[model samples]
Target chain A: MTDARRPLQIVDPDDPRIAAYRGIRERDLVRHQKRFIAEGTSVLRVLAGQRRFGIESALILENRFAGVADILGMLPAKTRVYVASSDVIDAIAGFPMHRGVLAVGLRRDDADAAPDTARRWRTVVALSEIANHDNMGAIFRNAAALGADAVLMDAQSCDPLYRKALRVSVGAVLTVPWHRFGHADAMLDWLETNGFALAGLSPRGDAALEHWEPPAKAALVLGTEGPGLPDRVMDRTQTLRIAMANGFDSLNVATSAALVLHHVRNARTGPASG
Target chain B: MTDARRPLQIVDPDDPRIAAYRGIRERDLVRHQKRFIAEGTSVLRVLAGQRRFGIESALILENRFAGVADILGMLPAKTRVYVASSDVIDAIAGFPMHRGVLAVGLRRDDADAAPDTARRWRTVVALSEIANHDNMGAIFRNAAALGADAVLMDAQSCDPLYRKALRVSVGAVLTVPWHRFGHADAMLDWLETNGFALAGLSPRGDAALEHWEPPAKAALVLGTEGPGLPDRVMDRTQTLRIAMANGFDSLNVATSAALVLHHVRNARTGPASG
Candidate 1:
């Protein structure tokens, strides 16, 4: 590895090499830059293991590097690693960052990112117009944990690769296959052509989730919290409702999705596989 | 009601009447004051309908007051309602509270807060050492949505009435019966004496969650995210596990709680009740 590409020490917060990492807290820096900031030791480790996305560089506190040097070495030697004091990191980030470890990950392209039809996904989590990053991240985390094969988000939904979303996902976003492109209607048509059952979750559904058995291939669709799936979307898919307490509001979108996915997976393969 | 007790107008940020609402974002003000701050119109509505706790006061932005005046009327005439401009409200809160609705709720006494045996709660959610307010709040929300009768927290758990937890719960904490006092072991003993199955959730448990039939009455206990329920507690209960994909981590504590509670309820009474 070249000297310029090796691990470097950063003393000044205003170092031009780490300019992209500045003002991270003040705005959506990563999304606008077509990259993402992965925080904490665990997320950084995930960024290193995957080749689907590029790990641009990393910034770690001096004391924390000894424990994580092995993980950081996993990244290509060309990936610049900057070690700094806590004060310099806090200054560069525009606030105190307790995690001390941060890395900027380059997102992959959108073309041909859909699931392979040949493999025939058992469960696909479909989310529409999910605006909150926390919910989006939690959905991805649930999709991965409950054994969903892929995660498909409509164009209206927020980016799963958003900094906070990736962090909340506990690095599942790096592992899970997700695509946030194309019209949802087109995606529904594709799923239908693939012989997949499209199950839309709603409070006013025709079938209770408990009674609706999972088919060999299925796409579970969920919408934003307040409005839920629109009329057109609901009409196109079989609606499934989770039983709620008398007149109580619906469960959190991600929570409901977990229950649905867990049930569908268990019903299909039995809980012993869980 | 006296004229002095009527809804009053305040233009100053430092007004002593609204001082308790100030610096809300800075520290754990509500917990220190032995009160909780409820935000948003939806939560305010839930607080208004419940008589278990006392409503001490409210602060609302001038523009948003007209839409909620009727709900405000639901409170007693003596409840102090302070109307303030957006600028003053933001200044007093030390941050912008977009919902424009805030209220201070006085907590009730803990004496005899345990579940009533005569009613025979179908399901109970018992948590151990849950520290995050967001997870804590989500647990209560799930308990309410999935029809868990009450929430019992071990001594190490954080307060559900903390402002952020209350907001995340969507006022479920206000409506749900919860007790934070007493040793977990004693509570487990009481639950067993009352003919309840003590099911402890863990990844390394003996019984798969799907295989374990929901008894007539059950108490489902979960722990925090990383280090799950202590071994001492796990040894005292029947272990139940949610199957995970190969080498994957466990689901969020709150998400798992929702799945368990939803399953227990549906199994006991069937999904038609959902």
Candidate 2:
């Protein structure tokens, strides 16, 4: 294929062009190198719909995929694509081919574009060490859906733009703005400085969820499952709990967040519906 | 190893002992055959704690898993416990071993054990074809925690007993009594015969959730993501919309169910606390 007309380049597995798709399952490569893979037509379709997320460096598909040529034609004139035998593509990725399409892109920083009014923000989500990409994505998806204005990740937070996170979010990560706070203390300072009420979601809190009304603009601080929010973080925030009947312990983090966000949103307006 | 106490088995890749865990990714076994997997120490602990769910066979770590052993001790003395090296276990499952424990359980037969009190039930959740195990588990977890009395599943519904579903539910699947309907018509007939009011959750519903004060007992039917409850189902049930801002399309089914369950629970008790 001529370079100008070929938006996608079909290459051999050994081609240096596809290095980004390698060793996705290796923890060290994933953690230290900060790279992952997004495969399949659905992910590509969603990524293409969001141009602002960034450039798609490579496209790998089976040679006979029906509409691969059409998608390649639609890419920005300069975009690079790769076509290979399904076996070759699977060999590079170490997994079976996904519906004959995959793309490699930069892992955008969670703090890529900060919210203008971070200082004035209320009803934010503070994530600490939430390493599971799917959970992180679900939280962002839920946060965006439930009207969370901002997201601040603590030191332990996973890359919000990781392919798994983005795919799980269904591209919501690109739309809902987020940032990172390297230090937990810095997060506390921001919450306090902004005059935001921080509701630390923990089982130890004295008040049941029904007992307290979320402030007009409050921040709901959620931590990873099991250990939950750290004591240091909770110390700076109001300790509130969702009441579970005897025997039950707590709700899933996203489910709990959704409950909290829903109530906080409801609180913004009068209870009785107009 | 003694056969009685050994509970130990070692097999090569070709051994039929690992058949159940094989080919998980190739086929939608959970959908086609109505099967699922339960995993990990947290899950085993939950299942053991809740006496209602049955204990099927299990794979246990031969070393460094005190929690798994503790849970296994609670299983029926006669139940088979296969012991293997962690690496062997990992290879058999096609994924990293989760705290050295996994169980396979039969799907609940809704027709056999649907609570007889459907006629007396006020709050209910009807899940239609929600394929994501995590979502299914989370929704059930939320429903159980939020005080929803019963759960009904349509034909397309994933088996809540599936392993991932159980893990996500924190074993609430066992604690929360549930029933399955053979078809949508069967579910509707049970609801109608029980004199239950149906609230179909959808984006286009005429009634906002805030305006809805679900009666002492009601059924909140939730459709899967994207195309919500079928129109016929919506027509038969009252449309209860969870109001959102302009840009957001809809909440995740699990998230939506949590909101509705909490709302209905609060409404039954009176207004939400501030």
Candidate 3:
């Protein structure tokens, strides 16, 4: 094992090697470099551990976080690991701290890999401007766990690799294969062309969730919290409304997605299978 | 209608009017205060739009936001509305911008309400720490939408009314009745005493979610993401594991709650019945 002291490379905030870690603002990364930050020991493990997520860089805290060091040791020796004082790390990230680790990676284009249709893929998720990172991450976590094959977000959605999202997902964001699509129209078009039946989740939808029969392949579309899927989107797909108690409006997008995903997954795979 | 012009309060950060918004450091708010912050028009609208929640205190951005006057005008005359310059508001909140509005509200304690008879309130949620405000908030949102009547949190849980919880919950935290029990033990005891059968969510659980028939009155207890509910808690309750794709470990806590809540609600009420 490469020891912490030997593996550690102390770098100031200005180190060009750590550019990905600097000025970790959402817009700056999205608009300027089209990248975002991922933090925590688990996310790093997921990225370096998984290998196919297209992660481009690594930045680890210099402290005695040997677990983080061990994880970094697994990465290619060429991967840049910047060890920083906790103060410098805080200043660079604009937060008090990360989970004793941080990394900056590319925001893969919204539509990166082509969706695999075969191999028993049944349920998937589509998101609108669900811009809250944590919600996005959680939804991904749910979709992955409920046997959803893919998670597609709209262009306006938050970067799932945002540090908060990574934490909220418990690093599931990295593990799950997620893509970004265009607006409702484009997403609808793609799903239709790809032979995936679509279901829009809406409170006012006439169909109840219990009656929702999952087609052989299905895509569940969820909108932002306040206003659900756009009217145009709902027009294109069958609507499934999760019945709620009176006076209660709706569930979080992620939570709603989970319920829908579970139903769809169950309908496709049969019961008691989870 | 009163014109929007008002004297901006140039009070120090220590001003008691903004006390509710104080100590909002992202981490300290979690560690020390056991809370996090949520700001802006959208979150507040969610809080206000929901009739079940109550207003705490408002920091109105003086004259900056057009079309907001009508909304502010509707507030009760006794409601504390602190008018501040956008700069002061932003500075006090430790953000570059304040979105022209902010409010601080107390965490709702719903546990005080008597748990209705098992037949009347067929579904319940028991949560472990789920300390992330967004997840906590999202869980409440799911519980309400999916027909879970009450939320019980163990000692390690996050403060649901913490601003982030309020925001993520879309103010559902205020509306959803939750109780803080000593821990899972106390919560489980209460559930059993109330004639509620307990279902613990775990990966190692023998009973899959689909296999278990929804009991007339049941409480589903969910633990954190990485570590599902403690073994002791699982030991006390019927362990139910959500089916998932083989590689994926588990759904996010809130999402799991939503899925289970949906199943329980659907089974008890019969879908379309709600």
Which model scores highest in TM-score? 1
Show model 2 residue runs off by greater than 4 Å: A1-6, A9-11, A27-52, A58-76, A83-85, A99-101, A107-111, A115-120, A271-274, B1-37, B91-95, B104-112, B271-274
Which 10 consecutive residues of model 2 chain A have the lowest summed lDDT?
A27-36
Each prediction's interface RMSD? 2.3, 3.3, 2.2
Ranking by DockQ: 1, 3, 2
Question: What C-alpha lDDT, on a 0 to 100 scale, does residue B234 get in candidate 3?
Answer: 76
Q: Is the docking of candidate 1 incorrect, acceptable, medium or high quality?
A: medium
Candidate 1 vs candidate 2, TM-score winner: 1
* Poorest stretch of ten by lDDT in candidate 3 chain B: B27-36
Q: Over the stretch B73-94, how does candidate 3's per-residue lDDT look in tens digits?
A: 6554555667777677767767
- Model 2 lDDT tens row, B171-207: 7787776777778768877887787788899987878
Residues A124-195 of candidate 3: C-alpha lDDT, one tens digit per residue = 788878888768877877766776777877788887766677777766776676766766577778777888
- TM-score of structure candidate 3: 0.84
Is candidate 1 or 3 superior in lDDT?
A: 1
Error of 1 at A138 (Å): 0.2
Looking at chain B only, the TM-scores across the models are: 0.92, 0.85, 0.83
- Relative to the true structure, candidate 1 reaches a TM of 0.94
Please give the DockQ score of every candidate, comma-separated: 0.64, 0.45, 0.60
Q: For each candidate, what is the lDDT?
A: 0.83, 0.71, 0.70
Pick the winner on DockQ between candidates 1 and 2.
1
What's the best-to-worst order under TM-score?
Answer: 1, 2, 3
Docking class of 2: acceptable
